[model samples]
Target: MAPAAAAAAQPAPPSLSLPPSQFARLQPHAYLLAHLSPPPSSNQPSIRANGRAPSQFRVTSANTGSLTHTNGSAVVRLGDTTAVCGVRAEILHTEDIASWSVSRPTPASSSPTGNKRRKLTDSTAKLSAESENKEEDGDDESQIQDFSLLVPNLSLSTGCAPGFIPGAPPSALAQSLSHQILTLLHSTRLVRAEDLRIWYQPPNLGPEELERHNENEQMDVDAPQGEVDLEKNKEIKAFWVLYIDIMIISLAGNPFDAAWAAVLAALRDTKLARAWWDVDNEMVVCSDAVSEARKLSLRGLPISSTFCVFEADAASGWRAVVIPDAEEEKELDDSTRKGIQRRWVLADPDGYEEGLSQERICVVVDKEQDGKGKTVIMKLEKNGGWAVDTKELKTLVDISAQRWEDLKQILEQC
Candidate 1:
């Protein structure tokens, strides 16, 4: 036989020597396709690459009080995603509180009775002003925590992910996530407002006398100091402001859930340094004693659950079977089956799964019931192209409630 004829008769051997780097690059795509595609036998359910059920979440772990300088700190890991949160408290005066409150002008309304004589009292006008301010704030309505501020900031660094760059100004994604976190904290009212209030005590002497005494104390180190009267300054005039910072240590998708979890853990562990006004020194003093510090009054623990929505592929045998015309059905091959248009919800999607998902929903729920004794949905955020129905949203809420209990137990352990 001729060499060419012999080579043609023998089939080409399989290519089994692909380079590791090339395989690594193609592995994700291949894996995704495999999961989306149905099994040859048509008896298996379409499973995640990690073998988890569609609605199942990845393993989660949390640790608190990790940073020494921060008043409270926590690190949360959900699968490969990692978020660290730190909370620092500061003192805010009455003027500072007023500045944080939005300023707005009140509108004059026409009298119901034409030319009716009506006099507006000072209290009524003040109430009207506050109502106008609240209206102007709209969805970004600020919560008055004894007029204290709670600022939450999120940072995504280059080390966290491949796309992020170091030294870059805050990205749009970071800003949006920070805003959402702040909104959730405020709306949930997790930290009690009254807990932030710092009462003011009047100085033993008048303002002028107190100034002179302060000067004298500064001038003469050997001079005997007067005892501070803690009971005198009982008027509320200041507050403890909290500054919450969240850092993304790693990016593996579902950052919102991880960040919120870290925030909850950190805030739960926060303790404020004991502060008192020193009438003799004419200044506010914080105690260095750890025993003097007080724990923050946390209202309720709210946990967040996130889900990613992907379009279901009917051709993937896991979906509903399609009925073709009687004649065509018998002749149809596996590849010839067309995919149906449907959506699938995946809970706690990792980076790879998130990449293929189009829509995302984050639900924040608290175990506490409102005055009406119903579970509170602290926050419900949905973004992307797909829409969820009422029934689906209700199911998500139920899932969130379950997650809340699980997370609460974890936090309690921390």
Candidate 2:
């Protein structure tokens, strides 16, 4: 064959471009190298894409009462991330409240003889009667059911990010995020349970007494109508239940902080309608009168701040760890003698920054009265294999306190 024909017959060289998966694996490293390294034009390091310092947060804004139909609603934005929270109020029955109590199933008896011998006896009946008496007399001590039920849910759809699918089952990330929000709400005790309680006077007359009273009233034409009606009695029944739903419109990063802020704003704006028991209908009635409505009692405003931890390169005034071969043992010894590896903590990390981070810490803080007045940490969540020092943790908490104050002021304005 001719030389040209032989050359053309040879297999084409492997494509220079990497496969999508391989490129994704290296993208974070590439981003870190480009952003952390000093710029060629200037000796100083390059600024982040949004021109923000490592420790600075993006601009934040909040608005409340945007959804008229909901009991309360709020939209919070931190840079490009946006979250909307809506609170809906509903009536809760006493039986439903009883079911909310945590219960554990008793294990079956392991021994066959014990199971066969188990039977109700006179003593068991006596014990049951005593328990019933205690319940009727309210002698048994138990936790008071003062607070209303709160249910929080989080949604992450395709519009919120690129990877999420539309109309698909909730991903693990969405469920985990919802669980974290609910945990914080309960642990922090931001909403007072007593504020959600609804009280009314139930009727005291039995069926026979009611029938006789109605007949007497009908027969007594000379009696003053208003005076006779004023002698009736009333009783309290149940309370309100709040359903909090949060949606992520855009997820740049640090969703936990944004979602929490939205929740706080919505809850602060919530107002419960007036409710009363109707003896005639045998049901609870809610008044539509706005004048009778009351705002929810908020215990304390808690705010959160998130930080991403990145491994700093040795050139950035920090030691870097690496396994050494026989020939490189001397370099490893020198690095160890110099110092331990150091990490860089970045605040309010965006999506790209989070991709490069190996660890994350979320700190929640609130102002409380503990010896006059003081700032207290409400919750702290750290994820990753990295361990943080005590001093560093303290510093992070202090920063969270400052952020809390700033966010509190913004929420008040909203």
Candidate 3:
């Protein structure tokens, strides 16, 4: 009896108190879910923990021509993540290339006929491929990748992220980003071959040289119409190589977007100095006058939007009710019984959100001017989870299209 009374008389222990910020850090997924679907009675807005809608992106800013020594430079900031890119132009003389050749390969000979049977076989497709190869040989888009004309390198500073060691070699993430950017540059063909080429016309052509050139042309009379002869009236002299270097000043999240934005901005701002072959000096000479500078004729501006899927683990027992209806509850009874998880799509995710979300999707799009502002998808990449279905993908594309408009405005203003 005395023991029972002592137990009953014990004062009630005080409930533990935890601050919201501390709770947020400890229970990131739960905190985000609460913010995404807030209870109606609380009168809280339906937004992410960072106070952004599911489709809302971070604020963006762009600056160009910041570096004096480089040919062009640009700085881009998306929310807290920032990246700077610098472009340096160098000349590569034609004579310096050891394996350079302008000669077109002759088409393969047909198989020897046996009783006139092989002579009747068709060779149109083979002929077409060989001739197209001959026509687009020298200055096709392949040159950009084959010769490595555009070199892009990305570096993450120690201060940019916590995992980056101070004196360590390039991280796998950095190397992967660099390769992705380079591949995109080549696939987009943003830079024109004509913009990088320098040519010279001889004062006169001798009879022997003219006759030889005429014979070469006569042999290729069956080539495609309107084919651009890379060395039509002038001889190739040199080519400009643009080396793009990107530095991550800060990394909040989505470094790829910021790095690519910086690259695009820098290329648009670039103005290569004019150069010509000096007959007397037998060398390439760059003009000092600013009037001779030329801006790159870039293709349509491509903007990228990234999204992450944040799935709440029902098995972890983290649930906060938000104004549930009886009918809806009954409808989801099977899924609830099955312990199926719920998810949210977060746009322009921050460092905190990135840690919680494993699945990610990035969409690159461009608004075609002549197509009445039609959105053309330049690239699409998604991995890590299967929560994003066709419906979710469509939603992401709409968000990306809107993002393109916003970025286009900022890019032009800069």
Compare candidates 1 and 2 on lDDT and give the better one: 1
- Please list the residue runs of candidate 1 whose C-alpha ends up more than 4 Å from where it truly belongs after superposition: 1-12, 16-33, 95-148, 201-233, 313-341, 369-374
> What ranking of all candidate models by lDDT puts the best one first?
3, 1, 2
The number of the candidate with the highest TM-score is: 3
TM-score versus the correct structure, for each prediction: 0.71, 0.68, 0.79
Candidate with more favorable, higher lDDT: 2 or 3: 3
Best by lDDT: 3
* Model 2 C-alpha lDDT per residue in residues 76-130, reported as the tens digit of each score: 9999999999999988755465543442112223233223324547887677567
Return the clash pairs for model 2, or none: 147-193, 200-235, 200-236, 201-234, 201-235, 202-234, 202-235
TM-score preference between candidates 1 and 3, better one: 3
Cα lDDT for residue 170, candidate 1? 86
For model 3, where is the 10-residue window of minimal lDDT? Answer: 106-115
**Clashing residue pairs for model 1:** 200-233, 201-233, 202-233
Query: lDDT score, residue 158, model 2?
Result: 79
Off by over 4 Å in 3: 1-15, 40-45, 102-139, 204-233, 320-341
How well does candidate 2 score on lDDT at residue 35?
Answer: 50
